[model samples]
Target: MREALIVWGGWPGHEPEQCAAIVAGMLRDEGFQVHLDNSTRAFASPQLSTMSLVVPIFTMSKIEKDEVSNLSKAVREGTGLAGFHGGMGDAFRDAVEYQFMCGGQWVAHPGNIIDYRVTVTRPDDPVMQGIGDFDYHSEQYYMHVDPSNEVLATTTFSGEHAPWIKGVVMPVVWKRRHGQGRVFYSSLGHVAKEFDVPQMRTILRRGMVWAARE
Candidate 1:
């Protein structure tokens, strides 16, 4: 079976395990051998080299140096790395190296987490294909994104109360090429129920498929 590993922990508000399970099912449906571990300890093993993809469902927290290195190296060698919202971008907040690999960090969620719309930029992309436009009544994230990314979709800060240091247009779905590996991220997923949305499910699944080391 094709292998994919999901590492989940940190904030419980995001329902780490549930969200991981949702993604796990998506991966499994796409013919992957999925493993779900709600811990940061898995990063201690070089066993990661055997997996085709590594997904971090973690929130704002610090991770060990060796764990970070293991994950970073795995992705560099062409293994997939993908996640959404704080689970991916906001993970390992205190580590500079982790942030560097993640490509962006969640700075804030302005307007107290309201509904917003995300527009697909690269419609021809495999991950973004068929996902024209959709609205998410969830936390609209304001992030500090990396310039070296192929932004797939962006959402504007339509909420009036947002403290956006950046511009109105912010990216929600993006992909980056780091070394030989493909890194994909989305700034949605604040709620575990996000997985229940058909469009969101399709988008997340497509990303996983694109990121997998096929």
Candidate 2:
């Protein structure tokens, strides 16, 4: 059976483990085998080559060296990486290797948790076929993104938070390749309510499938 190694935990504020379970169930429904872990250490039986994907729900911290190396190699060689918001981006900020594999880092989210809109940049992508530009009430993120990344959706910065941060556009959802592996990220998550939105859930569900590198 097709399988995925789901690594989650750290910072209950981001609800990484809980969210990972939600996503894992989604994959299980799709008939994929899943291995779940909520540890701050390395994978015990990690043979990156055997998994179809790696889902990290970790946030703002350091991970063991072995886990980082295995995950990096896995994605670089070809297992998919998928997660939303800070769970993946805010993780291991000091680890350049991790940041390099992640493609971007979370600098600041100026407006606080508030309402904002996301416009699809790659509307033609299968992950966004039925989903159109939509608005939601949550933390509107403002991040310094990777220019090499393929941005799929973006949000405009309004002068409400930082008048000086004007004319900046942030990618709310995107995808990029790490060697032969595919990676996907979305900045739409902050609170549990964010996951309840049909648009958010659908976007992530499709994104997971897309990131699975099938």
Candidate 3:
């Protein structure tokens, strides 16, 4: 069976633990042997490279240089990486290398919790197939993204909260690669309950599976 390691912990505001549980269950349902850890130290495990996938649920946390290095090396060597929201996007703020692997960083959520729309930009991609544009009620993440990322979904800023970005199209979901690894991310699921949203959950599910090492 494919194995997946999930490391969760950081700012409680994002309910990292709760979100991790939801993701763990999702992976288990998909036939993956899931392992969960509440500390970033798990990233340093020698076995990390053997796993099929790594999911980081840490938001705004500090990671040791060695831990980040090991995590990056594992992914670069072919272990897949997938995650959503601040857990992956806002994690390891001081680790620029980690940010580069993630393909984007969550810089702002203009109006905090508010309603927005998520538009599918790559419906033909396996991760987004059959998913249509949907209304989302959460932080419309304004991110600093990698230009090389294969953007799969996007959202337009209305300038209501951050006027300078009015009408600017921001990537909400994307998939990219780091060496032999597949990396996927989505700026949805501010909390565990967001998993109840079919679109959000389905997108995350498909993205995770798509990122797993074959």
Best by lDDT: 3
User: For model 3, which pairs clash?
Assistant: none
For candidate 3, give the lDDT of residue 40: 84
CA-only RMSD, every prediction: 1.5, 1.5, 0.6
lDDT of each residue in 1-214, candidate 1, tens digit only = 7799999989889888888888888888889999888778787678887788899999976789898888888888888888998899889888887788878999888776687888989999888777789888888888898998789899887547744343488888988877788888988788788887877777778887888788
Candidate 1 vs candidate 3: the TM-score winner is 3
> Which segments of candidate 2 are over 4 A away from where they belong?
43-45
| lDDT score, candidate 2 | 0.80
Candidate 3 ranges with C-alpha deviation above 4 Å: none
- lDDT of all the models against the reference? 0.84, 0.80, 0.95
TM-scores for all candidates?
0.95, 0.94, 0.99
lDDT per residue, candidate 2, 1-214, as tens digits?
A: 7788788876789887678888888889877898888775644345766787777788886776776777888788888888888888788777777778777878888778777788988889988887899988877777667788988888888878889878788888888888888888887777566788987888887887888867
Error of 2 at 176 (Å): 0.6
